[model samples]
Target chain A: MSTRPLALLLLALACTLRPAEDHVRLDERVGRAETPDTLVLEEDGLAAIREATPRGARLWAASPVLHLRLRTAGGPFELVVRNTLRDATLTLDDGTVIEREPGGLPTEARFVLDLPAGVERTARLAPPDADAAGSFHVAVLSDVQDAIGEVQDIYERMRADPSLRFVVSTGDLTDSGTRAQLVRFQEELETLPIPLYSTVGNHEVPGPEAWHDLFGPFNAFFRFRGVAFSLVDSSTATVDPALRRERLRPWLEAHRDAPHLFLTHVPILDASGLRSGAFRSRNEAASLLQELADAEVDALFFGHVHSYYAYSLAGIESYIAGGGGAIEEELDGIGRHYLRVEVDGARGVLGVGLVRVD
Target chain B: MTRRHGRRAQVTAHLLLALVAAGLPAARVAAQAPRTDPSADAPAEPPPPEAEPPRCSRARRRAAPALALTAGLLLHGTGHLLACERRTGRRLLAAEGLGFGALVLGGGGIALTGASRKTVAPFATLAILGVGTFAASWLADLYGTLSGGANAGRPARAAPFELALGYRYVHDPQFAYGHGLHLAAEGWLHRTRLFGGAWLALDDDTQRATAGLSQRLLGARGRGDALDAEAALHGQRFGTDGFRTLGVDVLLRGRLELAHLGPTLAGSFVEAEVGLGLQGFGYDATGRGVREDWNGLLLGRVGWGVFLGPSGELVAYYDHRRDDLAGGLSVDSVASGVLGHFGLAGRGYIRDGRWGLAGELELGSALVVGLSVLHRGAAPREGGAR
Candidate 1:
């Protein structure tokens, strides 16, 4: 009896685990407070996270460089970097080495340089892009949770499309909501030429704190140019009817006139409705579709169905862009791919193009 | 007696409330067809009181029990295990008693006249005794009818086809979303009832399906009176998860009636069932080789059902199974009174995982609602009473 109790205690402790520690983090001191977007890191600079941690992964190097949105026409700007010794030599894209100034703080390498705005560059110290929100070309991706190891091809594909501004994903960035999966996912994401904004999927439901630590929130609203995007939580089917009358209805009503796009991990109804593999309640799904139609939402994108499908329901254009390096479905006849959505400031959505990577 | 009557009243009340809530209103699918001929639809014209048969001679009234036995033995009438009342009892008793008594004499006489002494007397005697027992039971039924009780008549026959739709929430932390839609259909051909269904996640790319058949070898059409043998096949798909399953199941079920006194469980009953099955599946994650395996499992269940009038049933059951069906590849699901005709339903095996709190009403005829929904007894393509 006593032994059984002891075994249960240990089991409980094993399940409620803390985030794993990264063995590859640089121990060198750094200046300024590190965040997620500051330093430019190569593959070597990205620390591989330990597996099975409760909180998943996080990116920090004082601040890893995610994007350089240059707004000035042309001017001198300071670049910050970490994990270095002495005054490091900074190389430009053309292979020109400039001696770093013994600047700001001794813990980091800060370089002040002049560059033209509106131009994108990749270098040893400042792989960069200018702020160009005027052309909103986003790559929609999802369901790459356990397959981050195979995502390098996807990243390369995005880099090839310099016109693609960034990535917007619905969820499933990891397989088991583990720290290692998140870290690996983040590491692979850094390979892309642009940053990624995403809302958590069911796989990210391990705990809200861990998700908040990495991605801002499970549901969010952000706008670019003249179009708006809303990412809502459909992670749990059979949502309370009141949720519609409360949060969702008001939000949709507020943005009724704006060209808007909705993002979720699940669809209101599967195109293969015959299989009944869609929402829990036809009543609820029909209501959601009606609401979207009433709001005249531009498009709704989802990613739980590991396949590429495009269809319209209740007059709303919808697509399931789930081919994100996870297991491929032969029936879908499409290889691993992402949807490239072109948006014009004045005209709203132009078209959705399939970019196959595998 | 009063306790049982009160339960019947309570069950009737709940049944009515459930019926109204189950979408039975002006929006009903169709009006039920009348069962009787045109004249029967109107109130019966009263006959002169002088036409009433003289109350069974007081002496014959006391002999009603014996007469019931004699009539029932011949397979003719009924025996009223009666509770004397101020009125109506004897009227019902007379209908059952005299009717059955006539049949016993008639059917028995035919049996005797159809053969010679050696075969005739034995056959006649056997026929009389058999019919007598039948009549006794019929008379008891007459008593129940006079009581204006539910479950007063034989239960509705299982239609050739059944369709059900509902919602479910799974508690598998390893899986994607937890809630989804459920759709099922079953057909009857003689002794066999064939069924199939699917469960799909509302948000995630998860889906499961199953098909099966159950044959009632003996007993039926009433609560606590049944025996059945069943078999089935199952399949499922979790998109991108690279998981699938195929399986077989077999089982036997039996039940017994303890009392025929009231509607619902106010009438006592008992049931027992046992089953065994085998499941096989293929699973592959990452670049790992396709892994295949077969597993065998055991299951047991016991429950009781209450027949609540023209239609409707309330059942309570406890079930136990040794393993998860199809290694999580196939979802084993059901609608209506969890046991297919009773109350409660739930799926899972986390010690506290399996449970179902359900209620059904035969509204506009039959539609189970609350937590789950099941449209019962409408034959395929043909309109049957709801």
Candidate 2:
């Protein structure tokens, strides 16, 4: 069959994106963007009451900060930090303590910020006594496709481990990428103690405008301590070589010298060697694997397989940890688990510990 | 891709450490250790040798006949009868060619009717005819091949026409009661065979016709019994019990003989079937389509078949289909697979959504207690050279 018409139809659909509305509903909270930089946080039509950051911390001056974009505007702004978080310490660039209200659920850390516009601002919320260096843990999860019923136990298990800094997933957040499904997943995620960062999966699908509003970007990269975590949106089950060369190459090049990890929804090369399981073309997979090899990436993480498999691809340590509450592959011995990867700032990946529900 | 079978990772790690400590060449050690290790959770066992395939005495005997069936398909449906009847082989080949030609012609018609739904029926009809003919020809060639077995002493006796009779009871929600006398026949077309059956209502006037064609492809020995491959096409018209349903399926399946499983399973075999085709409804007198509405369908079935000596065979299976064909008699309603129905109460027998469990026995080769059948492994060898 000729593919021209189908391609054109997809192209036409991609061109039309729904405009954003005034209010954005995030998990349980609904709020409007107060300014281009700040967001006002409220619940149940409650007055926007915020606590101030202790006098010592000179960073964010508000109680709890929804989001603080660095100096986007001249501000004698007030940051409203949510009181729900347990004993939390907020910090900014240059080692400045932004908020330290002790570990209490009720006390809000309202801080008054006097900042000049037009500079970069990067601050992170970490537990009060977390080590500034050495080993850190990242929980890897994926394929929670409406297996919402069984996922609560998974979250509870994760909550029991305080050492896991953040949860990262190679997405399948919903069975079908619908707004309601996405919201439901978020509601379930709220039970987790930390945030989860994810790249979309084929199940999440492309062309869902809510994808952008829910997740950050199609492709994203961020560094923690010295390790670069790069995510390329290979959600279509096939990674076109041109896309790999153009978009993914730059990120690989920039992070080549650092301890780097790659994450995507579909495995670039299925270790199973089943043509039915992997990408459409072997050449594409080969090209992407070659690129990862050249960059000397430390480890590759993938989901889609709905089973846990550990192997090496193009000399890089790769793991498929799709044990998140989805239907287990036939004869794969169903087990719900996530990979707890410990990364050292000076060294590369220390070890990957498979923590299971049992 | 080699399927490594143990704590290969731990072994490899130890090997590398030992080599490093002993100042041995890393390349040599690396070459000895396989790169592809099976899933870590997989049970460990010694890897098979890289020599000739392991086989049993029975498998060695059936190799010749299995090869002949393979040759038939490779020879465009002529090889099966080549060792038996030259004229039959030539006719089977001719039928195969005609069917293939019809399929291509239908494909061309579809191209001509591109974006024009008005002319699809003609092409659709041609395509259906092509597949039907293909199935008939293959079944014909297979029967000639089945009779050409190396174990001629134990081979099934050929009858010009075979008749079978049986009885069955079905507890379907749509039909309060369904049980009747089942009668079926197998008629030979030259060397090929076609099967047709009907279940007459003993109590109610709900009658249905079951028709199908099947052919063996090849086989190879596994352990003590043979593994085989078969291609089949079947259709059912369900006006029985006031359910007007018509469904046709085509499958290319593989099976293993009962003995290969264990000494106790000497007369039964297991099979897995994957099929995709079209199905729809509406039937009239003459047991053919009156007005049809077709939709693409996907299906999978895993079954167990037991040879009841000369009494034919009995097959029990669990089927999964993307469509709910039997008036939604089974509907799990979840937009998910097997695990999705979790937490739901009482998702019964034929999983309502896309899964069903059924069992039936064929009375001789002529009568069937159910619409489905699990092809048997006739050869001593299993399918493939493996």
Candidate 3:
């Protein structure tokens, strides 16, 4: 064949070798910009309650206090604290002097409910005649991105045991919150067979509208089982003095009563006692967290900074589940993992397991 | 030029025909392996109690892509040796001889690995290409005469078709600052001698094809085989993010092609050259002289090919070139000829990944390099990821 004809033939062959597919779908799920209906906070209506007055704290104020008015099975309970610091002690309603550290409520501190001397064993543990109640299990997961296999593995493990009541994602549900990314999360969790709750992290807030929409009905401050779980908006954690004093203070005071499990994105004040502020703020917001910790809140779970960090502060136990998402680099001490919590009656047992999926 | 173009067209067509004949049949075999839906029979198979698939041998998985790439390189090498216009008959014979030897070695390596262990295919193919490069480089040193004309002595440039396949491993010294190093199969095929006209094959489906022709003319030189001037006319293309590129380079290379090595390798020439390439950056396929800039390159090479032999013998000393992109994005064009191919068994040359350096000049620019590693066996398939 002539060179022209031969060239034409080769061109034809090259053209015929069309690629298998033209558009390679990339990971593009930026999640629903607005809260999805299922994730909204509608079921727990009391969470909708707004405080009549805005409350706050001042650093200059001497000896700030957290007034605790919690009601247990036996009767109404009240404790008093003078300041927010390490090893602060609390006096229980029954004049029980508890030498409390500025960490989770003393692990051994438990109220031995008074029951009839001849009460049945079942009734003793679960009193049908109790004045106070407890029946909520919140799932806490961290560092769920970057390692899809690990996430899937954890999800599968959870699925095997249907006892899992509900799930709480500490934060960092994604490496990058691309649209498809959120979809992957939703698809993986759809098999969970229970509602999944999320506390907003820096990753979740590239824009308020998107995250607020993705976790709609389930995204609100609400009471689950019986414990009140509060999600502290990172927006309120900013260095903006006005936002800190005006916004966060009121939110904390209004939800002070019920057995509380606080959720936050960033860990407050590193071991060196320095606080991080959003938008380049300093330790200004540390006092607010101190006040809450003094109130003897339940475990506070957080994500971001993919590593496992646990600390105790003013009668409160704080657990960091940052390993729930993508882990960019290996930490000196922590591996990727999720916390499986078994909560029954008044006490909860937390176990951490490092999971890997091929 | 017309005769050269005609021969190239013929060879390309022949290669295309051969590739199609070989690739289509194997593709059919794969297509027949039950493409309908394995998910349908799930009820009977009962998911393997194990949740994840066992780790398969990496060599087995990479075989198809390896073969495809290897074949492409051999075909490309053959095209260049046959179509090059300025090369002497002796040089041409040696180039073809080297190319054929590379194909045989690469093929044998693949088959041996397959018969014994699947993991050795990529390494085998890499060995084949390494040897083939040395042959071509040595041949270039012989027949490619220098321009002793107006400016000074420089090699008469030949636009040989260049193609290669290899496996690559890269690691950045600064761990925290940049992305981690990765292992990938890569290849590139080009028909321009200026190192300016080439299509990079990243993975399998993505091919960044350079549009337009590039011409490099020789110029004056100083001692030590250095060139005084070099020129080029290239087309460029840029797509998404920092990957934006589509510009032509027009340069006058002031470098020598043959170097005078003393007595050991008598009359065997070894040369080094360096010069500036006036580059034009624009959004045109025909990369003709557009918005131009002075881009520089440095080349050094040496070879010894006997005048008579069934398969002309030549030792390719070295061939290296570097180009810098003005402003923030600078690319260092390189093609080094390693001493010997130890892993695949024989005396051969190796072309490390084509590295492009960026970042702080004081600390030296960061590099994004390309590699083409091959092993012996049936030639790797050409239509998949490298």
DockQ for every model, please. 0.01, 0.02, 0.00
Per-model TM-score on C-alpha atoms: 0.41, 0.42, 0.30
lDDT of 1 by residue, A224-319 (tens): 555677766555432324445555678788877667888877665555432223444333344465566667788989876667778765556789
In order of TM-score, best first, we have 2, 1, 3
User: Residue by residue across A1-358, what tens digits does model 2's lDDT show?
Assistant: 9999999964442221101110111211312234444433322211222222222121211111233333435466555444223445557666787764344223235545555564546555545534346878889999888576668888898889988877778888788778788778866766776667777676766334565555435555666667778766556544433345455678789888878889987776555431123433222343355567668889999987767788876567899888886654434564678999999767899999888873
- Between candidates 1 and 3, name the one with more favorable TM-score: 1
lDDT of 2 by residue, B67-162 (tens): 445765544345433343443444445545555555555544543322023343444444445554454445445543453322111112223455
* lDDT of every predicted structure (CA atoms): 0.48, 0.49, 0.33
Full ranking by DockQ: 2, 1, 3
User: Which 10-residue window of candidate 3 chain B scores lowest in summed lDDT?
Assistant: B327-336
The C-alpha RMSD of each candidate to the native structure, in angstroms, is 24.9, 24.7, 26.0
Please, what's the RMSD in Å of model 3? Answer: 26.0
Q: What C-alpha lDDT, on a 0 to 100 scale, does residue B93 get in candidate 1?
A: 37
Q: In candidate 2, how many Å is residue B325 off?
A: 40
